[model samples]
Target: MLRIAVPFTTLLIFSNCGMPPAECEPNSRRCEGDLLIGCDDTGHEAVTDCTALGATCVPQLTRCIVATPMLQPDAGQTIDAGEATDAGAEDAGAPLEDAGLPDAGPAVIDAGTPDAGLVCTGAFPTNTTAPAMPPYAGTAYIDADAMQATDPSSFVDLTYAGRGVRTMFDRRTNSYNQVNALLFDARFGISKHVEIQVNPEFTQAVAEQHARFYAHAVGQLPAFLFRDLDTMWIHDGNDLFGGANRNILIHVQQGRYLAMYGWLEEVLLHEATHTSLDSYHLNMPRWQQAATADRVAISDYARDNPMREDVSETVPVWFFSRFRAQRLDASMLTTIENTVPNRLRYLDCLGFDDAILP
Candidate 1:
């Protein structure tokens, strides 16, 4: 009887330089001195399961090969696979600290300093409808006349809820309008598996209208997995801001919620992803929750929470860029892969892979 050799645990191997058995049916054609690339995460090496533990084996010549690092850090960045994230246990939702640590509650950024409430702000380019998601009028149940104003300038007056006693930040032309679009798309995607609810606390009057649309869009999501969507766009007149338990509260500046809404839309999709994960599985640590969700770092929420943001950012990036036309830099791609080892799991949770983000 002849058999094909399986990969062995040890990198080095010693074997007689004899031709493979003619009846063995070699896996591939061979060369006199062909080099064998070690198996790693990028691809799999054909092998036979010799034992129940699924031990792999393969015949080798007299050479010991060093195990290559599974993940290689790019320049100026480091990849630490075993470095567990500092989250969930005591610091589940702790605020990010400036000194590479997390604060007890939340990080406070005085927003008004970023830009004038009416103009596009932040370091990234702004004022482009290309990134602007369409306003949610009929879809998310947004108020048509209000949230979807014809004159884009109407977005200038939208409210944001992130500011505390300190000053707030300004947003772009159609922040809230675009945000409504993102929320609608994400909600619909995740609603397939998990029951979901939305709570929009818009502090601005125009944003209040968008909140209404958001609530309306809730009904449009898959009825089976989604139980309901609840929104609170209007402030209860409360100024305090921090991470809340069981729900993700976005803090857009009052009067800038519209433009900020565009920014917040990505975050909303990310957070809402948590709800979907919870429905599919049991209670997991916040860090793992974000990891399984596969969010990326481009969004503000994901950037602040690197470990958790992995899934939240990944879904959007993959759906929008990889499967869709959107493109992400090499760094972003690396983050996505290292974050989630199982592509099937990530793609499975997000529903169909094509036409993911718009």
Candidate 2:
């Protein structure tokens, strides 16, 4: 019987070699002849036969480095698997540091202080509508007018009352507080199986406005991002958060942080990644490999919280560059390409079609 090898536990038997697999510390990689070997999170040997791919094994990196013909696809052309693989090799020369996580390697790249060219700034770019970088600005990438909810006026008559604890920012206290709050029965259905529950602290009018706006904005996003998201918790606080339990927490003040800022849709996308994409991709073997290969952090926030915030932080930027490139400026796009080429390519390779995207 022919057996297909799974990633993170691949066992490749070579007819010419009769050597036992060398044991190593978990998450550390090494080269064994033409084979790139690493210890997975479970301390099991994960082997990659580099010779088969016409690649060279490097002990410091996760992927076998290969030199392939680079293709420059026109703006209208779709990026193919071959392009993604070629792009991964662009930063192979950079040495990576293991951040002491199971599958995290910290990239030394800092956005604001790159060696040369346009330095990244906290100020939102004026040239395009790219979403504000998360944990940062609140500018809207997708215009408020663009994303009209399928049924903004749709309200489900389900009275859902529950006790929940979430981290909320208090403008008065000037800090985030873990508030044991009440989720009142008032709710609105924005999409199929999706509802937004507003806190009882706000008046009926305020709650309704908030619910309608949220429903319209969130409803426009690709459905796949909220697959596990059935309930959203809204309050009159000053921030937003995403929970592993498949929910998003919202605070009104985050949208009002600045007079020109407060693009909740952008923030919603960032938080949604935590709810939907983190579990599936966070510690996935391919994600780790891509991170190591890219060997650069998209932002300081991502670099600081490699395992926790990397996916959530990176996804908004990835989404903009891939699906909304027309809305982005040339310099900013160049920054993304220079900073996280491999990660961008990895996302491209995923081949998310209309089924997952809108």
Candidate 3:
């Protein structure tokens, strides 16, 4: 009865692509008929909160950016990013179904690199949309032309490949502001397959330091594709490296969610490390092997309910924090030791220099 996610406690159904159930947000069944906002050209009231949050806080003025390329938004309905919310409102609709193909498992990428390489530099698209994105989100297409035009071998760069994820999940995961936006940006740069090849010698060194810190829990992170990291820096509208933007995904927390910044970074690194090492199992798709390898990586908070979720955020944060210019805290280190086991050595068997910094 929540968003398309259905909140099965652990499982998320993705088989159906039909319109989502218009009842309540996932994990909650409170009524919201009065909190709805926005309207279509045909005079039909539009729901600003498809996930049944509070209400649209901004004015819903429908405006299209990029004007649309392929598979345009519906003529009557506004752009997915156009809707805003108020405090209390709910427009009734049908029961929502699953969002995307559900378990596509990150292997749908077909286009390899083009003839001329280096064209991929400055090529990874910073802003774009997928074709089948929900009516509530932004355009979901990944600009492949920009990719081929820049670095052809950027194929290993899962940033664009993972672009489809935005269209898959129905709700936000805390990307409503700056810090959280950076978190999403950071995750977007890597993949669930492999996350160790983080270039920029300093970053890699930081990762190694974290790896050593959590050596007991076995932070066996996978190596990234190549030495040349095809990185996409999400530049907030501030100075070259500061400020924030709207490209961040909005994630809604359920209960007892860990929102600490340091832990979140460890999760990003660890999960991104999973994305990097994930490529090793190309022989078996959907990452059954990769997911199974966590026995070594799983520990501490990782052993908690859906500890995988916590590990995905906490491991990287703890790892990265250890190497921060500021002295890393001993409590955070213990948090890693107790909650997560070190698993970086497993990648060493894959011919990855997990011990060495990028």
Candidate 4:
């Protein structure tokens, strides 16, 4: 994670609030809470409470800037920002199973509970049985039409970058391809920001649409999921990939494959896990120890590529099973519980907070 460092200056302050005022040089600019504090034309300190006028203190600007979009990262960049919320029923376009209520097959693990220790006493499996389908192949955990927090009505500015030729990986061909891409900074929500560079082989209308759609979808997820995700390269094809320098490659030809299965959002969730979690947890000794203790894999894909794809594959399954169990069928839930209880336990022990998640 990157830290924003603002230089501090010492100065005598007039007694008003007991708290000391934020220090500043004659022409220095910095943000102090909701106030934009800096030197005025006379080289004296001036304070403006940006929030009082429905604005925010952005250090880059001389004055408070008002916009529905979240405040941009201080000094043109930051690692994390924003709040989390559910993608309510308003946007859910997928069919949901209403089995009255979730069946009590296996005890559900509370996501918020802190792990006491690594306690996998269950018997290690000697043989592995393959799951029927990929976790995203069956039911849609993240509703395809789920209500987006993205306010299209709000102003969106393409701050920088321009038309240029860029190399983007095409997942369908499993190779890097050269294409003219429209590159720019797209900042939305309260603080969700990412660089969207799309293949301009598609029309400008289509490019902007893809950018907004993906931005909206990604915005619906918790901010923590993509702490490392910095850029999205949108191309044309049928596959998506994440990881390697914190990027997600998206193929916009989303018709037969993604729509037929309704795995668009779920697929993004998988890739996000790669960008945000793979480096920290995937190859860790504790994770390897947990795998050894459990000796089970949730899917054939995870089993085949244990080191590369296991965490990414299992996380979505764990996410739906633990957080959205009501939307899942009993048998599927049972499969998750039986197949990878130890994996679930390992995830639980990580102490991830589903903050603001409903």
By lDDT, the best candidate is 4
Q: How does residue 72 of candidate 3 score in lDDT?
A: 20
User: Alpha carbon lDDT of residue 169, candidate 3?
Assistant: 16
Candidate 4 — worst ten consecutive residues by lDDT sum? 1-10
Q: What is the C-alpha RMSD of each candidate to the true structure, in Å?
A: 25.5, 22.2, 23.9, 21.0
lDDT of 4 at 325: 65
How well does candidate 4 match the true structure in TM-score terms?
Answer: 0.57
At residue 110, candidate 4 shows an lDDT of 49
Total clashes for model 3: 71
TM-score of 3: 0.24
Order candidates by lDDT, high to low. 4, 2, 1, 3
Please write out the lDDT profile of model 4 over residues 1-358, one tens digit for every residue.
Answer: 1111111111112223566544546445567776766552234454556666556666654345454322221110111223222222121111222211223434554434333333434333432543333332212222332222331222234454678777776666766678778876777555656888888777877778777767665655545575677888887754434444467767664322332224455666667776777676766655676566556666545665677667877777777766666555566676676666556666654545433222
Candidate 2 Cα deviation (angstroms), residue 52: 57
Worst 10 residues of 3 by lDDT: 1-10
lDDT of each: 0.27, 0.47, 0.23, 0.53
Which one wins on TM-score? 4
lDDT of 1 by residue, 189-290 (tens): 432221112223343444455444443332222222132222222222212111112233333232122221122233333334443332332233443443
Candidate 1 at residue 179, lDDT?
28
List, in order, the clash count of every candidate structure: 50, 0, 71, 7
Residues 1-358, model 3: lDDT tens digits: 1011111111112222365433332222122442323222223222333233222222231111222122221111111333222222111111122111102233122122122211211112211221122121111111111111111121222221212111211122312222211111122113422222211213433434322222211122223322222222221111111001111111112110111101222222333433332223312222223323333223222323232232233323333322221333344333333322222111111222222222
Candidate 4 residue 205 C-alpha distance from true site, Å: 1.9
